[model samples]
Target: MSAMTGELAMCGASVETLFEESVEPVVELVLGGQSARVALFGATVISWRTGARDRLWMSSLSARDGSAPIRGGVPIAFPQFADQGPLTLHGFARTARWRLADRKANLDGTLVEARFVLARSAIADTQGWVGDFELRYTVRLGVRRLELELQVANLGSAPFDFTACLHTYLLLDDVRNVTLHGLSGLEYFDKVAGRDRDEVNDAIRVEAASHSSGDVLGQRAEGFVDRIYRAGGERSPLTLQHAASGETYSIAQSGFPDTIVFNPWVAGKKGTKGPDFDDDGYNHMICVEPAITREGSGPIRVSPGSTWAGTQTIQVL
Candidate 1:
C-alpha cells in the first residue's frame, strides 16, 4: 500500500510535500497566486498567504512537538468544545495525527482539494469514549476563496453527539484598526462576566461593560476581549475590515449556528494568559470561530450509519 496519496496540477494549483522534519508531515498547497500550508499532525492549516500578505497567523511560541495544540491558525475542535464535555479542553482532534485520505487538483487547475480522515481505530486511548466513528475534513482552496468542511459519520449501531468548531486565527496589520460587521442585535454569552447579553454595536462598538456587543465589535486600544456570540439562524455575511492594509475579508457559514470572537490583548493581565503567544502578538491576530458549543442542546448528533457535516468559507475582498 502507498504511504500517502498526492496529485499534480494543470494550471497552477498544486500540492507539495513540506516540513518533513516536524512531528507530522506538512503539505504546501498552491492555487494560482494563493497558497496555504497545512500540517497533518492535526490536519491544521498553519499559514495562508496571497500575494505579499498572510491571512492566517501562528504564534511564535506554539508547541510544535505535538505534546499540546498549536496556538494558532485553524485548529479543528471536535467531539467536544472547551471543557463542556468529558473530553479534553478542545477534544483530541487538534492534537491527534490525521491521515491524508485524498488529494486532487482540478483539471482546469482553478482549485485544489485535500481530504483527511481520523477514526477511533487510529487513536490509542480513545479518550475514554467508545464507538466506531470517522471524521472527514476537507479543504478546498480556490483562487480567491477558501472552503473548509467537516463531516462526521458513525459506523457503530449506537448514536453519538459531538460539538465542533474551526478555531481560525486571522492575521491583522493591527487589531485596533480592524472591524467585524453584520453582528448587530445578536445574543452572546460573556465568558468573563458569566452572563448572556445582546450585541447592539454598529461599527465595532466596545462598551464599558465586557461581553456585550454595543453598536460594533471593534478591538479596544488596550486590554483583552473574549466573548461567544450566538448567531441564531442568521446567515448574513460577516465582514472583517483590515483598515491599515486597506483590505477587507468576508466570512460565511453553513451548518454552523454560532460564532466566537476572542482576542487576549495583553498577557498576564486581568486573568488573561497566553503561554504560547508573544505579548505584542495580540495586536496582530484575532480569532473568529464558527462553533456549536451548547452544553446539551447544540451538539450535532449522528445516527448509526448517518452523517453530519458543516462548511465555512472565507474570501478576500
Candidate 2:
C-alpha cells in the first residue's frame, strides 16, 4: 500500500532490485484486486493476475509461448513486421533482450526515467531481420503522470520499416464504467467482420457506445477495434477517466498515426484463453494502442534504414 520512502526500492525485494539481482526487473503492481508484474530492463509487462480469479494476459497466441518469451502486458514492436517473412505475430523488437541504457529522476522525486536499448546484431536467429536498430524507452512517473517515450534509430546501410505501438492493457473496475475520450472522428477497420474494410466514421465517443455484454458480468463490447486515426488533437494525448474512483489516466501518443482499441468480448479472439467474462477478467482491461500503421490487418513494411518513434503518457487524476 505504501512505498519504502526515498529509498532505491520499496522493499528489500523492490522492483528495481528484482532486475539487478536476477538480471531481470520484474515488479508486481497489485491494486483494486488486480495484479501485474513488469520487467523494467526487459521493457515488458509480464503477467497480469486478478485476485484468485485467473490470468487474462497471453504470452502466446498459438501452440507455443513464442520464441522471444515475453510474459505479457505491453510490448514495443520496431522495424515492424518485414512483410511477414522471418518474424510473425508482431516482430523482433519485443522478442530480443534490450540493454539498460539510461536512468534519471526528477528533482522533486515525482518522476523517474529509465531507458532500454536494442542494437543491430548478427545473432542469426533473430527472426532473420537485419538492421542496426536502437529502441529507447523512457518511463516518467510523476505525482500525476506516468509516461513512456520510445526513441528508435535505424543505423543500417538500408532503411528499416515497421509500424509500432505500446500495447498496454489498462485494468478497470469494469470496462463498461470506463470512457475513452479524445477520439470522436477518424477512420477505423472492424476486424470481427470480413466486410466493411477500413471505413470512415464521424468522431465516436466512448460513453456513447453501448456496453451491452448482456451476459453474467455484462462486459462484452463485441467487435475488433484496430484502426488508425489522424490524431489531430491540440492536446496530443487521449484521456481515460474512471467515474467510480475519480481517477483519470491519460494515454498520450505523438508522431504515431494509428490507435488500436480492442475488447475481446468473445470466448477467445486468437486462440488465447478468453478472460472469464463470467468473472470479469477481459472486461476489466482496455488496450488503447498507439500504432504507426493505419493500414490494419496487413504487414507494415520498413525500407532498409529509416527510424520511427512514439510515446505514451499516463497521468492519474
Q: Which candidate is the best by TM-score?
A: 1
lDDT of 2 by residue, 1-317 (tens): 32432332322222242444434555544333444455643467555443343322443331122344353467776556223344656666666666556544444444455566666662336566665666777655444444667877766667656666677767677666777777655445544342233333332323213333343233343432433443422336777777777766667777666677766544333323333223334556667777664354343444445555567766555
Model 1 C-alpha lDDT per residue in residues 2-105, reported as the tens digit of each score: 22223455455677766655556787888878888888878888888886578888888787778788888899998888777888888888888888888887
Which residue segments of model 1 deviate by more than 4 Å? 1-7, 205-222, 268-272, 295-297
TM-scores of all predicted structures: 0.89, 0.69
RMSD of 1: 4.1
List per-prediction Cα lDDT, in the order shown: 0.76, 0.52
lDDT of 2 at 223: 37
After superposition, which runs of candidate 2 have C-alpha atoms over 4 Å from their true positions?
A: 1-15, 19-24, 27-42, 46-72, 81-86, 122-124, 194-224, 230-235, 269-279, 294-307
- Number of the top-ranking candidate, with lDDT as the measure: 1
